[model samples]
Target chain A: MEFVVFIIAGLLAIIGALGLIGFKNPVHSALSLVLSLFAVAVLFLNQDAQFLAAVQVIVYAGAIVVLFLFVIMLLGVDQAEDLSVEPIAGQRPIALAIGAGVLALSVLFISVAADGGATGQQSVTAEKVDSITGTAQSATAALGDNQTDGTETIPNIEQLGRTLFTDYVFAFEVTALLLTIAVVGAVMLARKPKGELAPLPVIPGRSGTTDETEELEDA
Target chain B: MELTSTWYLVLAAILFALGATGLLVRRNPLIMFMCVELMLNAVNLTFVTFGNDLNDLGGEISVFFVLVVAAAEVVIGLAIIVAIMRRRNEATADDLSALRG
Candidate 1:
């Protein structure tokens, strides 16, 4: 079951990613990205990171991609980009070569990695592994008792919440502050510049800034 | 065929590579931003895979922070893009050399 699920989800993810880059239209790319995000969320479930899977769908597919579409529409720049217009000769080939090199190096590193390459102390959430009960035996561990027989391990969300609120609580508080700052920054950035407007800079290829300058000056 | 953490790590690597290439090759600023989101998602997958392998909640918790930061980044980035595009109807990444100091 794990193999089957992994193969399907991984394939979908790859297809979505390819489509994201292959599509000429930004909207189609955004939609393909949604498909990829959903596939990744499925992968999260396979790894028992259920909480992340939910957030992956809700925040990424639901919120972030939607925001992308929103911006594309609002800007009215949804027209198809001219992919063949490569002002720099051979830039695509160089970029593709670099990407392939990165993939080859990472794969070589992982295939050589001992025990799946994850190294570090598995602390906080599952501190002690009780040999008898075959489950975590930590004080702060948030193991869920969904099954009366105690066969149920720690639920992913509960443990994540516990860890977030405890050992990494300060960092958690800081994330809240970061979000607030981001909101304020966005509002400031999107707002139009007011009063005594310097004339818009002259674009190299485009002609006519007088009309726009007069319009801004009037505002 | 065993579905190991290595599978996920490999998948993430491919995703990251694709995103990097797309960001590099695509002149459209919007598409480049989407590529950035793709890379972020790839990292999140790697983080979850590691968390599962290590049998720790820290990995999952770190993913939460990543999601929050990604959200904030996208917000600010899109706002800047909107601001820039408002000045001109169409502007590609190459055209955005205003910070050429």
Candidate 2:
């Protein structure tokens, strides 16, 4: 059952990503990205990272994509792009080749590493801990047997919350500071001068015959 | 067939590749930004999968940090895009070459 769900979600994610890259219209691409992000959230749920999955949906699909749409509509930049031109010559073929190479290498590494029996993650971690500490029984005991099945048997959200407040609180506060700086910087960069949107300056000497009318208004 | 951690890792790698290809092929700044977001999502999936596979909380915890950084990136990136679009009639990445000065 979980395998079926993973396959469906993975397909949805890949298809949505393809649409995102292939679509000429910015709005269509943005919508495609939303679909892809949502599918990823489903994959996260399947993996039992419940808090991260919910955060993925709320923050990514909810806030970030909405911001994309808001900027798109606000700037009125939804016009279809010209797909005919390659602004940077020879960029396309090289990029595709590199991308393909990367994909092939990654797939090869993963398959080769998993060639041994699928003993699952718990035993692997336990073995590493045992080797480092030179105590197999105690290391396995420390890691606990609850997760031997690879399904999140513990309440992940509770464990995550505890970890955040206890072990990772400083990093969490730093992230908050970074967000505040981003907000301030964005506002500063996007703000226009008081009269920036007013008419362009008309100088008679610099103006051509076509702009004579506007120059007269300036005088 | 039974799904394994390797399967998830492979899926993420493919998605990341697609995103990189899109980033290189696409000229529109907005679309390029979308590609970057796609790549980030792929990385997030990798982190979560590794975390789950290890039965460790560290992987998902790192994902939380990644999400925060991604959010900040989106906020700043879109603002930059909007500012550039306001100055020019079109928002293609090629047009911004004046900044190559």
Mark the regions of model 1 whose C-alpha exceeds 4 Å error after superposition.
A114-154, A197-219
Chain A only: TM-score per candidate = 0.77, 0.76
lDDT tens string, model 2, B1-101? 98888889999999999999899889888889989999999999999997777556678888999999999999999888877677565646765643333
Per-chain TM-score, chain A, candidate 2: 0.76
After superposition, the stretches of candidate 2 with alpha carbons farther than 4 Å from their true spots are A116-122, A126-154, A195-219
Cα lDDT of candidate 2 equals: 0.81
Candidate 1 lDDT, tens digit per residue, A1-219? Answer: 998999999999999999999999999999999999999999999988887898999999999999999999999888888887787899999999999998999888888773433453334223343333322224233343442343456556666666677677899899999999999999988887756553454333343445545544665
Q: Please, what's the RMSD in Å of model 1?
A: 5.1
Q: Each model's TM-score?
A: 0.85, 0.84
Q: B1-101, model 1: which lDDT tens digit per residue? A: 87777899999999999999999888888999999999999999998887677565557777899999999999999999998888666887877655442
What are the C-alpha RMSDs, in order, of all predicted structures?
Answer: 5.1, 6.1
C-alpha positional error of residue B50 in candidate 2 after TM-score superposition, expressed in Å: 0.7
